[model samples]
Target: MTATRQLEGKIAWITGGGSGIGAATARALAEAGAHAVVSGRRAAELDRVAADIRAQGGQADTLPLDVADAGAVADAGAQIAATHGAVDILVASAGINVPNRAFAELDTASWDRIVAVNLSGVMYAVSAVLPGMRTAGDGLVVIVSSWVGRHAVKLGGPAYNATKHGLVALGHSLNMEECANGIRACVVMPGEVATDILAKRAAPPPPEELARLLDPSDVARMIRAVCEMPARACVNEILISPAWNRNFIAPGEAAPRPARAAT
Candidate 1:
């Protein structure tokens, strides 16, 4: 772990832990003294992260999972619990923004993929662990949403925006309904940060806009605050924007870049 581990003894499961934000968060949590299990569809990537944690004398495990596959999400949670004894926190970061075409040009398959991974995937992860958290009477869940969730961006594809918007509602409902049950749910809506999600969208940001995105660590810092806070304190939401990203990229220069992945 790091010189000071804030989450020591806690157990956390992060979906979409194969790259970008997910990867950074996993390492950060490990450094903070938490036993973290990172999940993604890539076993090799997850295994590499696990080894890094091992080198630091922190606990970490790998689970290759397709978050869009409900069965896999459920099985991953159960496997994590079976190995770790308990799960005190969850980070639902698995998401996708692909085929950056306007709604008119977008085909059904493209839209479905975006919704499946960006919205349904998060739902699957949350549903898998909530029952156990309810039984335990305590837990924290962090949903990594986006600025598009709050305001639609005509510059980006509609399918991506829609899922993010839905995530806001999900986080809100979870917080309101589970508050009394000792389960805290929060959502984060961050502006662009550097990562490979742009690649998956089969696009890239306009070159001029590349310099102002937020960093992956910035989001990790927010999660660190939430997970380490006193049980009685909860940060309901976080909206992070780049200090210099005041303007949106114009359409036609290139496809817009997506936020960092949970990797």
Candidate 2:
């Protein structure tokens, strides 16, 4: 937590809040005095996150949802508006990947699934909250993109890379059109982080390599900073990675791959 309650009395809505960066961000925001409304597909996991926040003396609520469902996401947004009045901060962190990510193995079903959750899902979530933000004339959107969002990486696959890249354009376009309304949109592109999403990777990193990757909390802190900034300032984008970035290593010099069979 920060020394001051910068986000006190704020209403923050986080998608994919059941775990990973979303869960971490919820905790961080709640600690900073924001009432966090967490939304995800897992009810049990959402409950767990909310309970932990309450235990820590922070405000939190869970709204089970599947971002890929436009109607569901819109309903969730409406529910939040009815219950909380408005969402001051929107963190679009819901995302997914598959082990069969490479083009050679990528099937249409896999591609569609990833697009639904990664690309279309983000669009739905943003559209759901944009109206409220426009009405209030004050809003902050923090989009959790990926390292591949800015730089194309073969490991991330065509579907994942395309969707992540779309997020960048979406954020920029949001700012271009909504900045005058006092709404700020930021695209946070983080490198490989030690999160559950790694389980979907074709070659999951070994323990030693995972140890050096950025933790969920690390990315959460960066998000908190973006939220803490004054309403007058809008951080357009953030590209962050661990000091030991595997992406920077020379070809064929990668870390040892995990022994487990690919999912």
* lDDT winner: 2
Q: What lDDT score belongs to each candidate, Candidate 1 first? A: 0.83, 0.94
Q: Tell me the tens digit of each residue's lDDT in model 2 across 72-151.
A: 99999999999998899999999999999898999999999999998898899889888999999999999999999999
Q: List RMSD in Å for every model shown.
A: 6.5, 6.2
* Model 2 per-residue lDDT at 59: 94
Q: Model 1 TM-score?
A: 0.90
lDDT of 1 by residue, 18-115 (tens): 88788888888888999889999899999988898889888898889899888988888888778776589899888887665687788889898889
Which stretches of model 2 miss by more than 4 angstroms? Answer: 1-3, 251-263
Evaluate model 2: give its lDDT.
0.94
